[model samples]
Target: MEKTASVSGAQTIHKAISLLKFIARFSGEGARLIDLVRGMEIGQPTAHRLLQALVAEGLVKQDTSHRYHLGSLVFELSLTSGHHFNLADICTPVLKKLADETGDTSFLFLRSGDDAICLAREQGPYHIQTPVVPVGSRQPLGVSAGGLAILSALSEQEAAAVLKAITPRLVMFGNLTTDRVWEYYLKSNAVGYAAISNRAAPGVKGVGVPIIGEIGTPIAAVTLATTISRMTEERIQEIIPALNEAAEQIDVLLRQF
Candidate 1:
């Protein structure tokens, strides 16, 4: 009887996890109790009990209509897990110094869900500028050089999912096919840096180097954006070494954090 009871408890935990995954995948349209019960193929009473447990743990919340949605617990867990580091605190001063030295805009970005969130930025002395991706604004993971750098850091399965999520928006970029994206990822991995010219924005070009973590994963990216006219082959060659050196310094700082 004891062994049977333990098995049942494990099964119950698995069911609850499945329910949470279902709710998270469709967070925009919250799932009702009936919807969850039906989707998870569990009895109403079991579903209700599991949901109550999840709600008590702050992982799920009920709306006025009694539909279930993901709660703040997931966000809290993500922060605690160190998947989302506080880049602004570590990168702000570095970015300011880079901008001052390079006379080109510097940006720090990290992967957040299906978007790359700008965490810090510094403007350059040059009046010519690309549109600033504001701090905390989300950019599609498929288009921006910063986004591609982050995507390239993800494991294959995770990167594929991110690409699928951002596919619809790829239309804005003339011919960005999935094969091209995968090719870019492979190239970026090999070269240790990513670059795009006239793709993210017209007349704007950028290069990015990944800030690798202790475990060799890409934790964030440091990018430099400038007018295409200023990004001549010779100029790109000159900046690549500086960008690489700065990326190493930032990576060291991040690991300390």
Candidate 2:
């Protein structure tokens, strides 16, 4: 029999997160009940119970076909928590300025479970804007500079949980292991910024900074990307100050509502 990993003293939460992740993998079309149960290695009754709870909470929804998909609440929550909406709108101006001034592509990314999804993008004036990570695309945290910045800004326990959750997904990116992500986090934290190579695009590099919440937790990240030939070490250092400024401005704007 295959050994299944369980979180000590938090089995229910673990199972729930696992279920959600499993559903997300197939939720593009819709996830079937038997598939979810088998994929999560949980019994039918337990899966049903969890699914019901998630539906009630508006995190997941069951359609007329008896298949599940992520709910609208997820998108709403991404914008605000008990406040106004327009997260993308709030940050777009800052990103636009960054792109125009730096002559590189700028992106805004938000964390959703163990993955980072690009929320917005601003193309630079440069003729060759690096098509690193496209808007709406999601990838495991630490795969891109913006994601790495968010991961690095997380508290130790939070960061550990995210890393543990995304471990299996990292293999798709060549040589991007858990240890490698941890190393990236350390480096980003030390420099007060994230400068990562191959930001989901080979031969590309990106620099980013986290937008810290009032409690000092990272809520999102802003990044600028270009080809390796354009993102030299000195350039990375030079861009850090501007990136940090933009992140700070966005954080302040977020607190208004």
Candidate 3:
């Protein structure tokens, strides 16, 4: 009886996790029950029960329109400071300094659900800068150096889930596959940062470091973007320290609030 109960509980947890991921996929507009139930193997009754349990745990919330959204507790667990964070504003000074020091355009990217959003950019003195990703653009969380850095900072399981969620969007990048992104994540994890080239734009190169927020969760990334000419293997090695320092500085500043 005990073993049977344990297996059943594990299945329940798995279903709940699936439900959360589903809601996150459609999080922008929120998710309705029928929307969630459609095409999923889990029946409506089971999903509703799981959602209620998640809601009771503050992991999910329902609105007047009966739409489900990830709850404040989710942010609290990741950010710990409620909903008032201005990650770009907080990281601008570091971005400017990084750009000035490296002569490569610096970008601040915030993790938004399964996507990475470019919140701000600081152009360097380099006349041939490559700001391929403009501010306010969004991409899957394992696409560029910025997103890969954020993915590298997450726990193995969390990173895998994110990779699974973003696999469909990865195809738009020509050569990006879930396996390729996972390889990038593994490399970044081993090397303490992320670097990518010629993917976001031809001849573009970038190095990124993840910013550790409250509770040690990676909430953003600081990426130094440049042309391949300026970001050679030697320069990438040289620029990593500056990027790490800037990420640390941003992390420290973010904790103050």
Give the candidate number with the greatest TM-score.
3
Per-prediction TM-score to the true structure, in the order listed: 0.63, 0.67, 0.68
Predicted candidate 3 versus true structure: per-residue lDDT over 1-257, tens digit per residue: 99999999998888888888888787446789998889466789988898899987767867667888876357545653543346567778888999998888998887777777787899888787888897888889878789889889887877898898888878788668888888899999999899887767678878999986543557788899888787888988899899889888876776674
The TM-score of predicted model 3 comes to 0.68
Q: What's model 1's TM-score?
A: 0.63
Task: List pairs with backbone clashes in candidate 1.
Answer: none
Model 2 per-residue lDDT tens digits across residues 105-211 = 99988766667788889999998898667778898889988889989887666678889988998888876889989989888888788888864888988889987
Off by over 4 Å in 3: 1-87
TM-score of 2: 0.67
Candidate 2: residue 134 lDDT (0-100)? 72
Model 3: which residue pairs collide?
none
Q: Rank the candidates by lDDT, best first.
A: 3, 2, 1
Error of 2 at 143 (Å): 0.8
- Best-performing candidate as measured by lDDT: 3
Query: Please, what is the whole-model Cα lDDT of each candidate in the order they appear?
Result: 0.75, 0.80, 0.81
The best-first sequence of candidates by TM-score reads 3, 2, 1
Each candidate's number of clashing pairs is: 0, 0, 0
